[model samples]
Structure formats: C-alpha cells, structure tokens
Target: MEWLMYVSVAIIAIAFAVLVFYIIQTLLSLKKTMENISHTVDGMKSQVDEISKESTQLLHKTNELTEDLQYKSNTLNSVFHAAEDLGHSFQKLNGSLRKVSETVSKQADDNAEDVAKAVKWGSVVMSFWQKWKTEKTTKQADPGKEAN
Candidate 1:
C-alpha cells in the first residue's frame, strides 16, 4: 500500500509539470504574435502618413489647376465678347450699306424719267446747232447768195 501511494503522487507531479510547460510555450508564442502585430501596425501607420502627405499635395495641385483654368476661361470669355462685338459691328455696317444701296436705287428710279427727258432735249438741241452751222458754211461759200 505505501509503494502504490508514492507512485500515484509521482504521476500527478509529472502531469502538472507537463501542463505548466505547455502553458509557458503557448504564452511565448502569443508574445511573438503580438510583437509581429505591433510592427505591422507601425509600418501601416508610416504608409498611411505618406499617403496623407501625397493626398495633400495632390489637392493643392488640383486647386492650382482649377484656378488657372478659371483664369483662362475668363480670358477666353473676353475674347468671345470681342468677337461678338465685332460681329455686331459687321452687322451694322452691312445694314448701313444695305440702306445706302436702297436709297441710291430709289434715287435712280426717281430720276430715270428726268434723265430720259434731258437726253431727248440734248439730242434736239444738237440737231438744231448742226443745221445752223451748215447754213452758215453755205452762205460763206456763196457770199452773194440771199440770207434765206
């Protein structure tokens, strides 16, 4: 009976030691996993910071581009306005030319009959003058002829 009791006590002690050893090993492994997680978090934090800085720079560049585009658009707007003004001026010039052409046409139409009458009168006067010159030449050639 004394030998059996001693053997049972030794077996219980051995089992307790084994349990303790396995617990220690699990704790060590958990510690290593925690360290790796901490390092990964640090790396991720640095990468996030870099990304933030780049994002800020990109935002600033985008703003600059937007401002430049706005300025150019304003300048282009002025050019378009100038072109519109020029188009208006051309339209006014065309309208004035049209009015002048219509007025000249109207005056020509009004004077057409007067111009024809003047041409007829000029022809009649030219015929009388030619007849008078011919008579004068005939009288000069024949000095003793009558004045008829």
Candidate 2:
C-alpha cells in the first residue's frame, strides 16, 4: 500500500510538469506573435506618413494648377472682350460707310437732270462760236463781203 501511494504521487508530479512546459511554450509563441504585430504596425505607420507627405505635395500641385487655369481663363476673357469690341467697331464703321454710300447715290440721282441741261447749253454755245469764226474767216478771204 505505501509503495503504490509513492508511485501515484510521482505520476501526478510528472503530469503537472508536462502541463507547465506546454503552457510556457504557448506563452512564448504568443509573445513572438505580439512582437510581429508590433513590427507590422510600425511599418504601416511609416507608410502612412510617406503617403501623407506625398498627398500634401499633390494637393499643392493641384492648387498651383488651379491658379494657373484661373489666370489663363481671365486672359482669355480679355481676349474675348477685345474681339467683341472689334466686332462692334466694324459694325459701326460699316453703318457709317453705308450712310455715306446712300448719300452719294442720292446726290447723283438728284443732279442727273441738271447735268443733262447744262451739257445741252454748252453744246449750243460751242456751235454758235464755231459758226461766227467760220463766217469771219470767209469774209477775210473774200474781202468783198462785210461780216455782220
């Protein structure tokens, strides 16, 4: 009876030792997993910081581009306004030219009858002068007839 009790006590002690050893190994494995997680978190933090810096640069570039576009649009607006002004000037000039052309046409039409009457009078005067000169030449050559 005493020997059996000793053997039973030894068996319980061995089982307890085995349990403690497995628990320690499990704890070690958990510690290693925690360390890996910490390293991964550090790496992610660095990547996040790099991404933040790059995003900041990108934002600055976008703002610069926006300003440049605004400036160019303003310049284009001025050019469009100039073109509109030029178009208006041309329209006014064309209107003035049309009025002048109409006035000239009206004047020509009004003077047409007067011009015809003046031409007839000038023709009559020239014919009379030519007849008088011819008679004078004939009288001078004949010397017997007096020219009245």
Candidate 3:
C-alpha cells in the first residue's frame, strides 16, 4: 500500500508541471503579438500626420488662387466699362455728324434756284467785260476808225 501511494503522488506532480509549461508558452506568444500591434499603430499615426500637413498646404494654395482670380476679374470689369464708355462716345459723335450733314443737305436743297441764278449773272458779267476790252484794243489800233 505504501508503494501505490507514492506512485499516485508522482503522477499528479508530473501532470501539474505539464499544465504550467503550456501556460507559460501561451503568455509569451501573446506578448509578441501585442508588441507587433503597437508598432503598426505608431506607423499609422505618422502617416496620418503627414496627410494632415499636406491638406493644410493645399488649402492655402487654393485660397491664393481664388484671390488672384478675383483680382483679375475686377480688372477685366474696368476694361469692359471703358470699352462701353468709348462706344457711347462714338455714338454721340456719329449723331452730331449726322445732324450737321442733314442741315447742310437741307440748306443746299433750299438754295438750289438762287445758286443757279447767281451762276447765270456771273457768266453775263464776264461776257460784257471781255467785249469792252476787245473794243478798246481795236480802237487803239485804228484811231480814225474808232471815232465812228
């Protein structure tokens, strides 16, 4: 009976040792897995920070572009306004010219008959002067014949 009791005690001790060894192995594996997870999180955090910085810079550039476009648009607006003013000035000048031309045309039409009578009087006066000059020259050439 003493030998059987010793054998049973030794068997129980061996089983307990086996269970403790397996537990230690499992804890070591869990530790390694946790360390890998920590490293992956750190890498992800750095990448996210880089992305945030780039986004901020991109936003600033976009704002500058918007301001430049606004300035150009304002400048173009002035040019368009100046062109419109010039067009109006041209229109006014054209209207004045048209009025002056119409007045001149009307006056010419009203005085057509008067202009024709003046031309006829000028032609008659020129004819009389030529005839007097020719007679004086003929009389000077022949003094005796001129007395008649």
Model 1 C-alpha lDDT per residue in residues 1-148, reported as the tens digit of each score? 9999999999999999999999999999999999999999999999999999999999999999999999999999999999999999999999999999999999999999999999999999999999999989998999888654
Residue 102 lDDT (model 3): 99
lDDT of 2: 0.97
TM-score of each: 0.70, 0.64, 0.59
Q: How many residue pairs clash in each candidate at the backbone level?
A: 0, 0, 0
Question: Least lDDT summed over 10 consecutive residues: which range in candidate 1?
Answer: 139-148
lDDT of 2 by residue, 8-120 (tens): 99999999999999999999999999999999999999999999999999999999999999999999999999999999999999999999999999998999899899999
Residue-by-residue lDDT tens digits, candidate 3, 85-122:
99999999999999999999999999989999998998
CA deviation > 4 Å runs, candidate 3: 1-36, 119-148
Cα shift from native, residue 89, model 2 (Å): 1.0
TM-score of 3: 0.59
Off by over 4 Å in 2: 1-12, 112-148
Q: Regarding lDDT, does 1 or 2 come out ahead?
A: 1
Indicate which candidate wins on lDDT: 1
Q: Cα lDDT of model 3 overall?
A: 0.94
Which sequence of candidate numbers ranks them by TM-score, best first? 1, 2, 3
Pairs that clash in candidate 2: none
